[model samples]
Target chain A: MTTTTAAPPGGRAARAAAPSARATGPSTSGRRRLAPWGFLAPAIVLFVLFLALPIGYALYLSFRTEKVSGLGLGSGSRTEVWAGLSNYAAALGDPEFLASVGRVALYGVIVVPTMLGLALLFALLLDSRRARARTFSRTSIFLPYAVPAVISSLLWGFLYLPGVSPFYDLFERFGWDVPSLFDGDLVMFAVANIAVWGGTGFNMIVIYTALKSVPSELYEAAELDGASQVAVALRIKIPIVTPSIIMTAVFSMIATLQVFAEPTTLRPLSNAISTTWTPLMKVYRDAFTRGDLYSAAATSVIIALATFVLSFGFLRLVQSRAFASEK
Target chain B: MRLTTGTRIAALAAATALLASACSGGGDDAGSDDGGSAAGPVELTFWTWTPNMEKVVDLWNSEHPDITVTVNKQDGGDPAITKLLTAIKAGSGAPDIMQAEYQKIPQLVSSDALADLAGSLGDDVAGQFTDGVWDAVTLGSDAVYAVPQDSGPMQFYYRADIFEKLGIDVPTTWDEYADAARKVHEADPKAYLGTFSANDAGWFSGITQQAGASWYGIDGDAWSVDIDSEATTKVAEYWGGLVEEGVIDNKPMYTPEWNAGLNDGTQVGWLSAIWAPGVLAGNAADTAGKWEMAPMPQWDADAPATGAWGGSATAVTSQSEHPEQAAEFITWLNTDPEAVQALVDETGIYPADVPASTEALTDPPEFFSNQPDFYEVAAQTAQTVQPFTYGPNINVAYSAYNDEFAKATKAKTADAFVDAVDAMQQITLDDLKNQGFNVSE
Candidate 1:
């Protein structure tokens, strides 16, 4: 469930290290190694306690299940039984799990591209000199990031309702018929819109910052060669920010894979989303709602592994291309 | 790179150490050898999601100054269960007492997270509640895991004004209900008899129970699951036909759209549990005095039956240091007249007591047109509700039903409902068998 939250904190440390790695290239590495390790002891202790322990325990639980002997009426009757690979086999073969995977894959296809494209567009707009109300627009686009996913889904859920929605009221006035947003086909877009709204801003900020880091002389050099502002942005600005864009895409994909809060919060308003709407929600249903911790643990491990492969695969693809030119 | 790798390895080793410590420290600190009667003031923690429960807790605290209880409000539904499970698995942070829904009792019992109160409480304790309510908390004949706090017997609430306008009397049988639904829809294109919420799996479960569908039954030591029985299929076909015919709007409940439908008379009635009156009263105050309650429409004209829906009980966790005191509090809170009355007065939760608290039956809120007749009808319905057992896999079964119901509603087909129920029954049966329980169709 917290697959999204787990990535961000770890991502923050990497983000913090990116520029500094270049700044302190070969200097002061060996001299302060022990001192830095001593200083990092508390963080290491906390990281171990909070993150690694829970993960290790989930892995251990994924391989074992509770078996009921007689009646299953008392504590003595139920015993933990080791069932190697069975839970994973069950999760993999389950049609519901496969359906959830398909739904999330479709969701990712819609959300990631739309969100990144809009973020790139907005970042370029903000970096341009002639843009109007840049501060207001930037803040407005990024504002949703401050609102939690649950709250934004709730806010959008109301706006999507026919009776309470101003948009529905407007549509009626215009004599235009519109289907309810909570209907089966349209509900996915409604959910995807919420994710895109909440995400584009943060990714925009990351890309915008990366665009700012590119030397002004590069743009000046391009402009001197009879280049337009769009040409400079499309060629010079975008390529320089490829690493940041790739990082954002990886993070967005990870978040999209674990879409729980939006669909869950929207459920009270829409019937389109089931309790097992996403893989993470399914894992949660198994663990707490069904009290099948072993199945839940196995599902989570599967999700975590999927995320690892997707993120690393993208990073490796981008690294080979980007670094080949650098070398 | 070297520094980063070193820190990462150090973090990994530290995490391993933390996990090892957690494993070794799994034993319960509150040993039963400490004796039941602990001296001095015992501070007990209680968690519940029911709003306005403060008055009940306050009354209990005032009465038992020696055993002060702290009330903490947790979120309802799956999230609350998640918190409880995490606390239990962590071997700490569990509240002594918590509110558990009736359907969740079997699951919690299987987890070994609850203490058996049958041995500690007197024999008369189980007899205080109605049969349906008592069976919800009791494992068999002897083992009681929780105290029945409130109940929701299925009831039909209709818009009296709308029925009069449509020139129709209240429906006594489901056939008449369907005819009225069609007439109401034909009379006003904007209105329907009721909205069918496909997402509301629990409500459908209750209706099926009313139709004499026993989804879960304990036969000796094994569990019998029949989710797609004749009765259940009948219910599914009836509702699925209603959806397909446009006699009912397939809208999700508890949303703004549903509320607007009620307030504006687009939806004429709600077929739900006794809790419907309170919810409708709170959400659509403009429709006050225009609504009336009746016993749920029967599947057969000669049969007088109902089903149970949402109700909760106070259960003692296994981690509690003072089980006897906790049981005493739970029993007193549920059975004692003052505490039960306080709960009704504060939260509008109808008591599950057999005799029916006088205060609950007598007091008529103005929101229901100042009529207390519904209370008596509700109490009678509560008594007539079919007693059934919820399996440990009930939640999973519920979600599976919800998934299938949603598909059936969307596809507008009776066959879809049958297929959904078939898949649900098969999934749960396999799951139980895999879990080492003797499950049979």
Candidate 2:
């Protein structure tokens, strides 16, 4: 709603300032003074409350520890003391925590590339003119987007069962040895597949929208110059949607870092998935299960900081190319 | 003339204040009690996860026609606790009677969030229930926080036809059990004696309890972890060996593979509690008459004959509007023979009330091929259970042990397995210490 209201006023200002800014340009001080604040307010408010406030709270909590004096006999014996960096040191030194983070990193390595690649391919295919049953294929592929991650994991979990699965049944009919998807080595892939199936369609739609926003005039010019559809898609369309792809990639990375629901839901089906299967899962275990919210809060802050550093570092590295045309 | 920014801020503040005050005023008005209970009928809300509570509610309603009881079907254990905690924190809209698990009873009782039911119920009502059931709901020694609902007596359910086919006898000792399992697997290359889900500590707990492993001791406010004891190690080693020998099917519970094992006869048997029979019936309808119950194998022939698996209790929350009525309903559900019978007839829940089981013992069902003595499981439950203390962080300890057990079982050698268990025990102790549990070195 704000986008609609703000666009008209913003466009008029942009048009008015364009010529003068283009001439004096390097420093559009007048427009820059009003533009940045007006554009940033809504996002800044959300970021402060949802992101910065919680991080600050967690940071404060992480540095504090409960001290129990003289047998901890009563309420008087227990007091809150400043812990400083002990909790962080403990969490980092923990073998279980390190192992869980390593497992998740490996899982992300397997999942992120495969999911984004499939999403990009599907988006390109949907954009192609000669593709058959486009609407049906698009809807079917995107249908999983409507289902919650937990529900999709449950469905896929049942399908992975040797007795219930149609795929397993076919394997049995052919007298082929079908290794259990829930076996120790393969369970990570099973969990990753659930996430990919649930997420790829949504990413595909984002990429597709970005592709659609690309000017058709570019394609027409390429066609007149005797370029193939593949060539146009590779050279023109991809370059145009690079920013969106990077955004999706960064989001996917963040999401993969916080993978909890799929693995948690699938735990009822596989013994290989420990309660501390992922870093977020370990945080949950520490907080609710172990009732060590102090450590849990500390671990969460660590994760949040890692995510911010990773996403920011990535964006900074890619900003020159992806955001170059914006200014 | 320039308008001050303070004036704009004042205008916004005044509007927000007005809106907040109006909302608060409305909330206060609705929260007030119009008159005393003597003038009108009292309506109480009862929240229960067990489906059998509907019949119990119906029985209660018929007895006291003037008082209306609204039974709300809440989701199972963890979600119910979360919902209750949230409602309590919000300071409104909590149910009067909540079904609580035994392990959670200590946490709830210690928090002083539950009403003292012992005063209202008295000895007559409490006397009829088994001591184990009663002890589960008791907080310290004398303060009864809740009333017991059902008993989870662990039993071994095996396929008789499969046992005969494999030429293996029902084992009385752990050694024999392993040998039989090995024989079964040799006979049918794909079959396993039982399934163990590494995440499930309930089954492991039952095994340890049968081996006479106590979790915690209560000697004047001090607590100790007995997980490093010899009995617990023996049980863990036995399970680990089974895993190595491939005698046990390592399928996760509630999975289709587990369900298939139950129905398709890929699994020879399962170690289940009293409630498991009902679960099996509910899940595997096609595998109806193929199942028969046997007692769980002992570590040695002289070991204890029984161990408790899963059970739940009903508690009246501190926020209850009618604590007296809630306590009365819970007392009857736990002790009254007729009420317990009604619940069993309605929900197939094996009642923990000793007197109730005596009366309900004759009821025959076509599900188990008209087995008239279904309550025999209850009798065994009462005889075999040794009291064990469930600590505040028992859930955490259970999960930690479960993960460790999986790791140990999957290990190549017995030494490696023992080392893994030792590591798990140390970590568990450290975790308990961190959570403010009184752990002895």
Candidate 3:
């Protein structure tokens, strides 16, 4: 969703740095000290241009706003003025913005847990020696991540429509009444379903890699002690992959907060999704649709702060409790 | 010091961007200097969404040898306006010509995105369109922002077969329409007269306009919002009551269910605009001969009136080096008899240039071939379209309408509908004040 915005800031610095970095790999001499500097220059440039500049621009824009004079006709009638913290204050006070944040929080709560659980289950199943068609099952589970979010959302959106859905026919055949999976309370679940379908594969692969990296001796020792396969997985494999689970959980939490593509793509199919259905969506609408870039910038800054606090706080909590026994 | 340095670098980058745009503008100046002369060839890019607009532009290109117009097809209405405004802020990449909606003229003008064509166009250009249509581009001022192309004077479209089958008369007034809706629903529980589209803000705005409500009014230099005006509340209550009583469907238009309803003869009537034929043809091709067009049922039958939904004008962007040439092409494209004929034949639009539209739209569209006098009634309805002013904060109000009306439609109550209107008014007014626009209390 933000590929267009992300490209411009990072464009100049991210160009053709790979070849330069690869060519000058840590020449070990005092005389060749400048060689490593040449390699590091590209990454430094990218960080400054992509990360630092955009953040700075957003901060500057958040503190300033347009002052529309009488009628606001002609050029210079709408002039930029120092707004201080007014844009931030307005964003926090806006009911619509608050509603959007709350909705995304609900969406995150639905998506993250369900997605991680399915991913873990799939990983555990594939890791068992008794499992058959392992490669086929693994590929199929991981395939959805290859499809972009927007495309998957559209696919699910059509299936959710009663007039076009095969499920509609099945429901009628069963003599049951099921309304559209859009609008009202049902839309949140509909959006979360698409996210889980598209996201589970990637998370599954992460857990699978962590499972493979675990020593086989632990499972053997558990089995020799008369533990079942389920017992072995629950006790040995699960405990070993706690860090990977935490990593994936943190990533999913961040992605959940920044859920833009699925809801935006499904918007035309349902009136349930507002322009400010999510905080990122709210920023897009305010900046592009309402033509209020200052408020949009402020909202972005606030959302960024929230994402940092939430994800880092979760990491701190997990490290304290989940890793205390391991340490 | 480092934080201030970040601010300084950011400011420098912005200045560099502005300078880069200024340099590009200089380049276009050089290119357009040659364009000013008849001997030099000029190329112009136009962005529009009207179907088969390229054929109309081809006629212009053939007749005018020195100037070449390239049509870049875009998504209609709001998306196109959004892109244009984005380009305007970025200070580059806007097309030489743009398709501007009537409601967005003030926003564009205030943003300084559109070039006012007061000096570029001929005096006769103002006389080509109705005063109401002309005033839309000008914002009650003398500066012309765009050349009027098409006008959507809304009319009622109904299934004549369904009306006849139910033994109901074609409704002529708002009260009769409600009675007919109830009768139709009673005869067949699956069917409805029409649906109240919560998603379609323009559809609701047009209905409000038809009810003698102007949501925005400009006095002196201040803008006043009236979304909660008595006329609009009355209009909302009328639809809300029907929905609440389960006579009218609460489903939105342009949805798959609505399309299925149309195909199955469960949605009997549509309150839509002049371009309804194309949409009907696309959605429910099987219902071709069964449908018919009529004037929108009047609030007071003694004085008939209607409102606009979707129409756009040909505008020149401020970034365009050759506003005069762009204006000339637009004028000829909209008003020239040959160009208008080609436009009508190719794009299937109801031209806003009154004389050209009258001359070109002699025959009915293919989808409504059952009614030979379709354009005749359309021409008459076009004349009765009421004038409405648009403010800069229209986007804010439209989004609010979507959110509030969705809830109201779900609640299915007349009171909720009225409250939705109140919410829209408050949101729009607050937005204007927050954006620092001078708004009257």
What TM-score would every model get versus the actual structure? 0.89, 0.84, 0.91
Best by DockQ: 1
Compute the DockQ of candidate 3. 0.24
Q: Largest TM-score belongs to which candidate? A: 3
Worst 10 residues of 1 chain B by lDDT: B1-10
Quote the positional error of residue B136 for candidate 3 in Å: 0.8
Which RMSD values do the candidates have, in order? 9.0, 8.9, 8.8
lDDT digits (tens) for residues A148-175 of candidate 2: 8788888998888776788998998899
Number of the top-ranking candidate, with lDDT as the measure:
3
Model 2: residues with Cα > 4 Å off, grouped in runs: A1-90, A128-133, A213-231, A291-293, B1-39, B65-68, B87-94, B302-304, B409-420
Mark the regions of model 1 whose C-alpha exceeds 4 Å error after superposition.
A1-37, B1-38, B356-360, B370-372
The 10 consecutive residues of candidate 3 chain B with the worst lDDT sum are B1-10
lDDT of 3: 0.86
Per-candidate Cα lDDT values, in order, are 0.81, 0.73, 0.86
Which regions of candidate 3 fall more than 4 Å away from where they truly are?
Answer: A1-33, A321-327, B1-39
The better candidate by DockQ, 1 or 2, is 1
lDDT of 1 at A43: 99
Please give the lDDT score at residue B126 for candidate 2: 71
Cα lDDT tens digits, model 2, B1-441, are 011121222122223222322343343233237223466666677788887678778887888865667899988887777566545433555677888888777655543357777688867767766676777777457777888887787877788778877677888777888888888888877888886567777777767777887776566665666666786787767776777677776666767777777787877788888776677787777877777776777765665467787788888987676778778777877677778778878877777777777787565444566344555654764578766767655766777766775565445345645665576667766766875656666
